[model samples]
Target chain A: MHINMKIATKYIVVAILLVGFTSCQKNSRPNYQYMPNMYEPIGYEAYQESDAFANGVEAQLPAEGSIPRGNFMPYEIEDTNEGYELAKASLTNPLDSTQVDFVRGKELYDVYCGICHGNKGNGQGKLVQREKILGVPSYDDAGRAITTGSIYHVIYYGKNTMGSYANQLNEEERWQVTAYVEKLKAELEK
Target chain B: MKHVIYRNLTSRILSLGFIILLTVSTSLSAQEGDVAKGKSLFNANCAACHKLNKPMTGPALANVEQRLIEEEGLDREWINNWIRNSSALIKSGDAYANKIYNEWNQVAMNAFPQLSDQDITDILAYTAAPPPAPVVVDAGADAVVQEPGISNDLILGALAVLFALLALALVLVKRTLNRFAEAKGIDTVIEEKRTPIWKAFIQNQFLVLVTAIFFLLASGYFVYGYFMQVGIDQGYEPVQPIHYSHRIHAGDNAIDCKYCHSSARVSKHSGIPSLNICMNCHKAIGEVAAETQQEGLKEYGVDYNAEIQKLYEAVGWDGTGYTGETQPVKWIRIHNLPDFAYFNHSQHVSVAGLECQTCHGPVEEMEIMYQHSPLTMGWCINCHRETNVKVKDNGYYTKIHEQLSKKYGVEQLTAAQMGGLECGKCHY
Candidate 1:
C-alpha cells in the first residue's frame, strides 16, 4: 500500500510539473517586429547614401536601376525632317512578324494621321487636297533613305505641319503604327 | 518484479502528464475569438465615425475601457445605455454624456438598440485588446528576414530535430527504467510480441506492390497539390525595404483605403500608393513614439518617427517645404499574380462595390501587408461559388442579372453565373 501511494505521489508530481511548465509558457507571446515607418529610411537612404541621387528630386521619380528599353531613338527636329525623307525612300516592309498588330496599326493610323498624310500615302492628304496644307511627300520619292528611328521620332515629336502625338500613342502603339507606315510605303513603292 | 512494476507506472504517469500539458497549451493558444466576424461588425457599424486609436468625428476607441473606468462613473451599464440611447442618457443630466454630446456638434450617436450585451462586449474586447505587431518594411532588413527561400528548409530542419529529440528522450527513459528493474533483480519478459498486421505486411511478398502503389499515390497527390498552388501566394509577405504600416494609416487613423490605393476603383491593379500619395499625409505627420524615443535618430535625414518626413524624402520635398522636386516611393511589389491573371480592381471595387477587406483580408488591421488571400485558382473559384454577387440597382450588373434570370432560376444569381468562375475571369 505504501509502494502504491508512493507511485501515485510520483505520478501526481509529474503531472504537476507538466502543468507548471505549460502554464509558464502561456504568457510567452511571439514577439512580432512592427515597423510603422518603412518608407522613411528608403527615401533618405535612396537619396543621401546612393551615388545615383541627384539633388532635383520630384514626383513621378523613375525607379532605381530602371533603363528605357528598345533602341535609343533621338527626336531631334533637324534629324526628324531628314528621317521622314529617308522613310519615304528605303524602309518598306514591316519589321514585326504579327499580322494582327499590322491590322491594328492600320486602324489606328486611319483614326489619327489619315487627315494629314492621306489614305493612299500619295502625299494627296485631305489637308493638301483641300489646299489647306501642302508639301506632303509620296512614299516612292527617291533621295531620302528614312531609318525606323527617324520615322518613330517624327511620329512621336511631330514635324513641320504635324503636332506632337506622344500623348495619343503609348510606346507599343507607336511601334505598331511605325510598322504599318512601313507597310504602306512598301505597297506604294510596288 | 517490484522494480519492473514501479518503472512501468512511472513511465506511464510521465507520458500521461506530458499529453495533458500539450492539450492544455494547445487549448490556451486556440482561445482566439472569430476576428473575421468581429471585423465585419466593426466595419458595418463603428468604422463610419470611430477609429481604433485616432480621433475621427468622435473620440479614439483605443482605451475606451480605461476611460470609462477612470473618467465616467458608470461602466457596462453606462456603455449599454449610451449605445442603446445616448439622447435619453444626456437628458438625465449626465455631465460626461452632455459634454460628449456637445463636443460631437450634437450629432446623435446612432442608437444600436438591437446590439446585445454580448455583441457590445466583443466590440469592447476588440477595442481594449492591444494592437497586433506592426509589419517590418525595412529593405535592408528584408534580406536578413528572407535569405532567399530558407524558411521552408529551416521549418523542416526544426521539425526533424524536434522528432529526433522526442525519440531520444523515449529511448533514454526506456533504458533507465530497464536498468532500475535489473538493479532490483526483477525478471523481465524478453519474448517478442506477435508482429502487427501492418509490420508483417511490410516484410511479406506484398512489399514491392505496396511500395510502388504508395509511392505512386503519394507522388500523384504531391503533384496535384503543387499544380493547384502554382500562382497562389496566401501569406506572401515580401521583404520590402520600408516598414510601412497599413494598420496605422488605415485602421488607427481611419484613413480610407481608397485614399492610398486610388487605382483600385479605376485601374487593373490597386497600384502601390506612390511617394506623392505618402506625401499627402506623411508630409506633416512625421513622428512615431517607439521609433523616435527608442532607436534615437539614425544618420538618415529620413526620420523613423516622422512617417510624413519619410514621404517628403521619397518625393524630394524640402520642408520649407514645397520645392516640387518629388521622389517616387519604390514600394516592393507584394501581391503579384502572373500577367495572365485578369484581376480588375474596378470590376470588384467600383462595379460590385466590394470592400477591400473582402479579398485583401483586414488590410487596415495588417501591420505588414501580406497576400492574405490564398490567390489560388481553386480559392478564387470557391469564393465565386459561395459568394452571392451584389446585384442590386448596379447598372452594370442589372442588365446581366435580367438575362441570367431569364436562363437560370431567380435564386440570386452568383458572380459564378455571370461567368465569374470561368478560368478566363481570373486567368487569361
Candidate 2:
C-alpha cells in the first residue's frame, strides 16, 4: 500500500510540474483578443497596400503648392547657384531672438547634423572619425564662411556630399538647427 | 655600430624626403596662390560640380595640369579660357574642348568669370594634392576579448554533482541508522508495520475532504492562469525583410533612436526610415566587419554582406550613381495595436519624454526585434496610473498644468490624475 502511494504521489508531482513548466516563460503565441474585427479596422494605414485606394497607392501627399494653415511662408529660392547666392545675400530667419530656443535647437541639431557635423561642430563626427566619410570642413574653416541664409539654403537643398534634411526635419526645426549651428560656429570662432 | 649607422641613414632619408616635400609644396603654393587660397577658391567656385578625386557632374581634377599639358597637348592658357567660357569654347569648335564635352555627356560647365588665372592654378594644385590621412581611428567594436565568467552550464554541473553527493550521504545516514536500530534489537521494519500513509489518509474523511478541496482550488487557479494568457503576444519577434541589428547600430555604435526614426517626434507613428536615410550612412558603411560575422551573426547563420547587397539592390545604388530603380523593403510589422486602441508615438516619446525602452523594452540588446511589452489595455492603464505627467517647460501644457495641480492639490501629478485614464483619450 505504501509502495502504491509513493508511485502515485510521484506521478502526480511529475504531472503537476509538467503543466507548470509549460505555462511559464515568454511565449511567441498571442493570447486571445475578443472582437478581432475591432482589432483590425478597415481604415487607411500609411504603408499598408490595399486595392481600396486608386492606382493601388498606399499613402498620398497633398497636391503641390498647397500650404497648410498656421505654417510659415514657403521658401521661394530655387535649388540653384543663383538661389544660393540670393539666399546668402538677402534671406534671414523670421523667428526673433526671443522665439529661438537654444536648448531645443541644440537637441534638433544633435539629431540631424551631429552624426556628420560633430556635436561640437569640429567636423570630426563619428562617421568621419571612423573613416566612413572624409573632408567635412569645420565651421571655422576659411573655405566655408557660411551665413544664416547660407545655412538655411544648405538645409533646404543640401550641399555637396550632404543629402537634404527637408524630408526629416520641418521648416521650424530646420531654422532651429540653423540657429544651433550658428551658435556652434560662433563658439568655434571664439 | 653598423646598426646605429643604418638607423641614422634611414632617419636622414626620412628627414630629406620630408624637406623635399615641404619645398615642393611651398614652390607649388608660390606657383599658384598658396594651397589654402587654392582650396578656398575651389570650394567657392568649383565644389558644386567637381571633386578632387571623384567624378561627379564634372571629371575629377586630379593631375589635370599634367593630363591636359602632357596627354591632350592642350595649351596651359586653354584651361583659363575654358573655365571662363566653357560654352563659348565648346561652341567655337575647339577640337580638344569639344572632345572633352563629347566624352562626358554634353553637360555645360558653369562659367566662373570671377576666378583669376591664379585662382584656377590654386584650384588645380588643391585638386592634385593627395588626400590627408585619417588622424584618429579607434579599432571598431570587435577587438575586445571579454572574459566570460562562470556560466549556467558550469553551475548546473556543480549543482548536479552536489545533489548526487547529498543523496548518497542521505542513503549512507539511513543505512547507519538502520544498523544502529538493528544493534539495539529494534526491528528496522517497524516503519513498515505502521498503517500505510495512503490508507491512514483515506480513513480520515475530514482530512481527505479538506486536502481534496485545497488541491482542486490550486489546480483551478493554475488552469485559469494558463487560459488567461491566451492572446497576449509578449515576445512575437517576426523576421524583418533586412536582418537589421539594433544591437549593432543602436547599441554598439550608439546611434540615437531618433536619428533613423526621425518622424517619431512629430507624427502619430514612429516612422520606418526611408531608403534615402539608410543611404546617408550606408553609402559609405557598405559591409559588416569579418569579426562581427564570426560573432552574433554566425550564431544566427546570417551573411552580413548579402544583407547589405540586398539594401543596395533595393535602393538602386551601384556604388556610383543611383540608377533610380527602387523597391520598398517588405518589412513584417511586429507591433500591432488593435483598431480600438489609439497610440501616438509623439504623445508618449516627445510630450512625456519617455525613453524608447519604456515600451519597446531593451531594443538595443535584441538581435531580432520583438514586441517586449504585453501591449494590452491593462498594460497601458497601469503605466498611466503610475507615470507622472511631464508638465514642465512645455508651452502646450501651460493652462492644463495650472488646473491639474490645483484640482489634484499636488505639485507633481500622475498621468491618471491628468485624465489619462479617460476612456475617450485612448479609445476615441
DockQ (CA atoms), all models: 0.01, 0.29
Predictions in order: lDDT = 0.63, 0.79
Fnat per candidate, as a fraction, reads 0.00, 0.37
Segments of candidate 1 deviating more than 4 angstroms: A1-190, B1-203, B207-212, B290-309, B323-326, B396-400, B421-428
For residue B324, give model 2's deviation from the true position in Å: 2.2
TM-score of chain B of each: 0.49, 0.60
**Model 2, runs deviating above 4 Å:** A1-31, A54-57, A80-86, B1-211
TM-scores for all candidates? 0.38, 0.68
Candidate number of the best lDDT: 2
Quality of candidate 2's docking, in CAPRI categories?
Answer: acceptable
Candidate 1 lDDT over residue span A1-190, tens digit each: 9999999999999999999856633322211212324212333221223544454332235576565778544333344334554554544333448543876687567645664466666665554454333345555444233346656766676543344555455566677878777778888878
Pick by DockQ: which candidate is best?
2
State the lDDT of candidate 1 residue by residue for B287-357, as single tens digits: 55544323333323334556556666666766424566755555555565444456788888877778889
User: Candidate 1's C-alpha lDDT?
Assistant: 0.63
Question: Per-residue lDDT of B1-428 in model 2, one digit per residue for the tens?
Answer: 36665777878999999999999998766466467888766664665456667676578787788788889888768988898878789888899899988886665665667677777877777766767764322244223322122455678889999999999999999999999998999966744477889999999999999999999999999999777766577888767889988987788766789988988998899988888888776665566655666564436778877888899999998865689887878877778888888999998888999999999999998888998998888999999999998888888878988998998788888899989899999888
